[model samples]
Target: MDQAALRTLIGQLADDLGWLEQHARTQPLHVAQAAELHYAGALVRNVVGPFLEGHAALPLHVAVVGGAGAGKSTIANMLCGAVLAESNPQAGFTRHPVAYAPASGAVNWPSSLGFLGTMQRLSKPEPSSLDADVYQVRRVSEEAGQFGVLDKFLVWDCPDMTTWAATGYVPRLLEVTALADVIVFVASDERYNDEVPTQFLRLLLRSGKMVVVSLMKMREADAPAFVAHFQREVLDKMPARAVATLTVPHLTPAQVVDPCRNAPVYRVPIVNQIFVLGEPVQAARQRTVRSATSYLMSHQQHLLGVARDDLLALEGWRQRVREGQMEFDNRYRREFLTTERFRRFDEALVRLLELLELPGVGRFASLTMDVLRWPYTWTKKLFASAFARPEASSMPERQVLENGLAGWIDHLRKEAASQTGKHPLWEHVQHGFSAGLGNTIKDRFNESFRGFQLSLGDEVERTARKIYEDLEKNPLALNAIRGGKFTAEVTTILVSGGAILYSGGLALPFVAASLAMAPLSASVIQMLTEFFGSQYVDFHREQTRARQQALVAQHISTPMADWLTSWPTTGGSAYERLQSILGRFPHNLQQMEAAVQAAMM
Candidate 1:
């Protein structure tokens, strides 16, 4: 790739890398894969970030990363004008990453704009010491800055991964590796091809990180063959997708320690120039980034599918709950409202009203007459008999309703259980808890009904009882209590006829007296009877309505509410919400298949 095209590609890679970093932060898995993917993202960002910016600058970031006393610090020194990194024999001496930038301020260092993610900017200058795994930017001395045309190259002194502390610091190692366009994976001739470095190399290859491997302390004669063997044995084993590989020649201690004494500018031939003067090897870098991006996109659905599957499973649960709700509605309507017990309730109210007006015991004149009347008596009797109390046949008692509700709840629990399958939250709901659900729901329903129904029925029933008691106390003992005035014309006709038939002119008065008294008494009784019958009809109608309301309030609504309330608590969490959608799926597929067949027609 030409420079501008390379820059554009770098920008694209950096943008993609940023997306991956955010994804990693938000969607970290419980396993090692999350960390590894995050590390890969970091790797891509670091290498590509610099190229995206319009700097003619190409600062190859070469990291000398390995275990303690494995010549990492020495390699760092060799790359940075001799012994810049402390070559302490003590393990874990270098705790952090150090950057040696070219001292000459001729070409400015590129701002870390496109550096994968945000980089920590350090204010301190010149061979600055850093905490482990953190990188510090320091200017390279003027004498050691000869290799590059533009002067912004830096060598990083990374921590030794073999140390106990390195596990925590590996992220820092990865961060430096990601930013480094050229990573100098430093290992001694002895430490080369170990598992840690090998693993790191695999990671770099996956992230498309370029590698300039340095095998330190090797004899000159063995170096070339050793490089070839290492390439075949180690590099070839990696996915054939690595960007580039470079092997640094081994250096003597004398060549590593002093920069000015050696004829070679840094006296460390392989490391100093490879790290400071390395370029992108643009074609290879592009190829690597492309492959890595392709792999990431290929597996994109895998990550997103986790959330999708969870939603689908949850929806499945919802559908089952909805079906259960429908079942409950059907059962409640059929089994309770249309029940014999409810019909009996209507009959009972009628009977209680009938009890008020007995056959012989009308204390009130009006009631006495009414009870004696055939029409009034038969109407009340017909009402009581036709809608008579049930023969206790399937008539649910209070206990039965409770049990039914409880059983219904149990059924719901079973349905929920059956529907949940292996869901994580299913065990929270068990059948025994259905009792509590039934009770709570039923009680709430009862409480609501009690607010309106119970008091009204009690008052109406109380009034009816009082009226019955009063009528019984004051029976019609005198004819004056009844109203003969109601049938005065009939009385006159009867008296006149009796007088004409039974008495001559002399006995007419006597006949009239007997006829008038009997006829008037009968007329008074008949009037009273008519009045009582009408009152009884009105009272019976009222009682029937009251009883019907009481039954509904007491039995049906409360139980239904209770059952519905238990649904969510019993492992059917919001399950009903998705019922329609899920239920329609099989049908929807069928429709689609039918449509396809039709199209084929």
Candidate 2:
């Protein structure tokens, strides 16, 4: 537990807590968790770290805290044995904590670095009503009879907790509270059962600070009953700690002005209680440290819950990304895969058969066959030329791909729009979707699709070339297959012509043309059917389909998926920042926690 090392660790913890506080949005748990983190950091840096470094414990802090107009300043004035703070009649008058130490400055206070967490130290005197993130230290005159009994202690007069303005300066209060070893809780007759101050008391008690409840602005006669009621309603339910409850009778301004001198009899009891709690400074500091650590340990689940909420939000974003990917893939399959004809496949088949022609001898054999069938070939060509229809116009592949991608982008945008208010992630995605995100997606998709299209021709040609290359290795089998294909063509053409002539009618021209070219068309169809049935061709076709599917996925599906998956991390997105901060804060806290525990031991 090197003091410097401990200070460095605590410093980092303070920074992490500050980050949490800044990002705490609207959730109550998130806000409370951030406050708790700040409190923990303050304790480590201001109390534990300084104590370990052998800093003086004599100047033990005693903070008087309560709701607005709860007689907090009166208690501070009484503790100092004089009117050191302004006890105004206005509610929420005290907006910042004012520290009252001995004029002699006998005890050295902890530096501002970790003293009040993020609150700045005001060098010039400022009114307690100055509502800001700051604290000011002022030394009170050291009259022999005033503050003489509590020479080694520093008393802090803190702002009211129940005021709306308190939100702006409550961190200042928590900061002073974290520095305190003892707390003098002031509650007027009206505020005794108030929810806000009671909860604050509970937090203090839970943190293990020594507390003395001064029930103020109550008649002396009703003190007993009030004390009993306060004990039953507040004290009884709180965990056992070193706590004392007393009654401060309502007083006039004159009496409050010089509480110790004018009402010496009334002030003696409160002074005695303070004396009892502040002596043996080492023991008091240890109690504070142990109490803080215990509170942190007990509330570990709460802190973790805060982190879990953040991660759950992140998970929601990831789930949306996956859904978007699925939608994209579905659209591509429906718009592209289902409608695509792959007409190039037919051309590829013919080219593959041409490659299988025998190098020299097979050509001569084929030529002799052509000469014998010259009359049939000539008749088939004449009729085919007369009846051939023009190829039908269709959508270009590029247009189809672009249309499908646009549809997918539009679908995602609509989904985001519909789900905008459902969750934080959705809201973030919705905002981004409207901000040119669709254009970015389109650009990436088009780039990938272009590359895919360029390689498609080569892919089909390669598959056909492979079939021919395999056939060339087995010339005898190739020639036999070719001879059988030729005979099948001639036989089919003759049968088709006989059928057309026997069933003659006014439709003779069209039917006759179709039958005449039946030798070439029917033979090619039969040859392909037989070749596709063979084990080798079947394997090749399967391979080609698989490769084609892979190409589609790589170019289109993969790009869309990648964009959707990574959208949350893109620059300027709220989710990206949330993810980064959430990850870093919790991990740093965990490590700091371990270091703190070891150092304490």
C-alpha RMSD for every candidate:
16.7, 8.2
Clashing residue pairs in candidate 2 are: none
TM-score to true structure, per model: 0.47, 0.71
User: Which candidate has the top score in TM-score?
Assistant: 2
State candidate 2's TM-score. 0.71
- lDDT by residue (tens digit), candidate 2, 1-601: 4666666666765665555556564455577666666666677667766665657667778899998888998888888777878878999999988888777745586663576666787989998889888888878777833743458578889998898777777778888898888899999898787887877787788777888889999998898999998888888988765378888888867787677677766788888888887767767776776666666557655544555655666566556556755665565556555555455555556655565444466687556445545665577679989998875555565676677667666766776677665556667777777777777887888788888887686776677567766777887777787766666655666777776776774586768675567645554554464466454554665677667767777777776776687677668664565556555655554555565456457
Off by over 4 Å in 1: 1-29, 40-57, 106-119, 125-134, 147-152, 218-233, 241-251, 259-601
lDDT of 1 at 451: 55
lDDT of 1 at 507: 78
List, residue by residue over 62-166, the lDDT tens digit for candidate 1: 666766666777656556654466777677677667777776564345554445344465566433334532356666666655532214346787777777666
